[model samples]
Target: MNDVVNLAEKLAQFSEHWSPRVVAELNDYQLKVVKLQNSFVWHKHDDTDELFLVLQGAMSIRLRDGDVSLQAGELYVVPRGVEHQPYAEDECHVLLIEPRGVVNTGDAEDTRLRADNDRWI
Candidate 1:
């Protein structure tokens, strides 16, 4: 069985950004960690909502209406079916809480930045 997870330690296991690694699970949701830099694709999940909690640096979620900025310890929820793009000027660490099997790229078929399902750190 797995013991308590150290987020900073888990995050240190990977080098690439924009890809989320599963860290823990609760009921039907998964807690994931990801490193973010530059920009991500514009996409939306029709089946479930996505939660982003910043752990380090800052993040900016670009929506059609406007942009939502988040700093360390801050969070933002992208409601289901809403289009959004995430980016960071510098490297950012974040925790993503969402339902199991939720795709990283949502329903978008851009073929870029598609993370493997159930990947763990």
Candidate 2:
């Protein structure tokens, strides 16, 4: 029999900071969970839009035009081709919904690239 996986349980298994783990999949899209602090690299997905849903804590998105702050239960959509950076003062849990093959770092090829792809908890 298949076991049911709860997101809260899956998130509990991860302790690494700033790394995103795959949690589920819907069609060609992937659902990811990540804990974040400080700031992420400035990048943009030239092909697909990215969605960020705050599960806990708070986050801020820095864009070329301005920045947006997100609290718990808040969500933001970064359109394709728009450069942005994410940051948080305290640790934050977020759910990211995006298309398959979309890199977490976008066009950036830094050490922060999360190699795990499309993995489901």
Candidate 3:
């Protein structure tokens, strides 16, 4: 069986904003897909690095040090234990890379936990 996935097709399967879906896994890491708009809570993953890749639309990562903007075809990594928030003016599709068990809202838990690691595709 083929282990690879078509990113475009995977993204097309969901339309929920801020909810993440699992696309693939590697060792202890996972590849997740999420649609974002508006602002996310400020938080940090104390033990894992977070990666964001813009698949469609635009957004920005607000960090304690500064903010980074991303357009389609762009990507950025938020190192472990860094305080940051993600925001988007309009609908945006993105991919996240992080170790398994990493929560979407980091340590600050709330209603934002749309799906857990096990629910990912």
TM-score of each: 0.97, 0.90, 0.90
Local error of candidate 3 at 107, Å?
1.3
Off by over 4 Å in 3: 109-114
Worst 10 residues of 2 by lDDT: 111-120
Residue 79 displacement in candidate 3 (angstroms): 0.8
| lDDT for each residue of candidate 1 in 13-114, tens digit (9 for 90 to 100) | 999998899999998899999999999999999989899999999989999999999999999999999999999999999999999898899878895899
Among all windows of ten consecutive residues in candidate 3, which has the lowest summed lDDT? Answer: 110-119
TM-score between model 1 and native: 0.97
lDDT scores in order? 0.94, 0.85, 0.86
Cα deviation of 58 in candidate 2 (Å)?
Answer: 0.3
Off by over 4 Å in 1: none
Off by over 4 Å in 2: 1-4
RMSD of 3: 1.6
- 6-119 per-residue lDDT for model 2 (tens digits): 777888997876677877777888888988889898989999999999999999999999999999999999999999999999999999999987778888767564546665
The model with the greater TM-score, 1 or 3, is 1
Expressed as tens digits, the lDDT of each residue in 4-117 for candidate 3 is 788878888888777888888889888888889899888888998899999999999999989999999999999999999899999999999888878788877655543555
Backbone N/Cα/C clashes per model: 0, 0, 0
Clashing pairs in 3: none
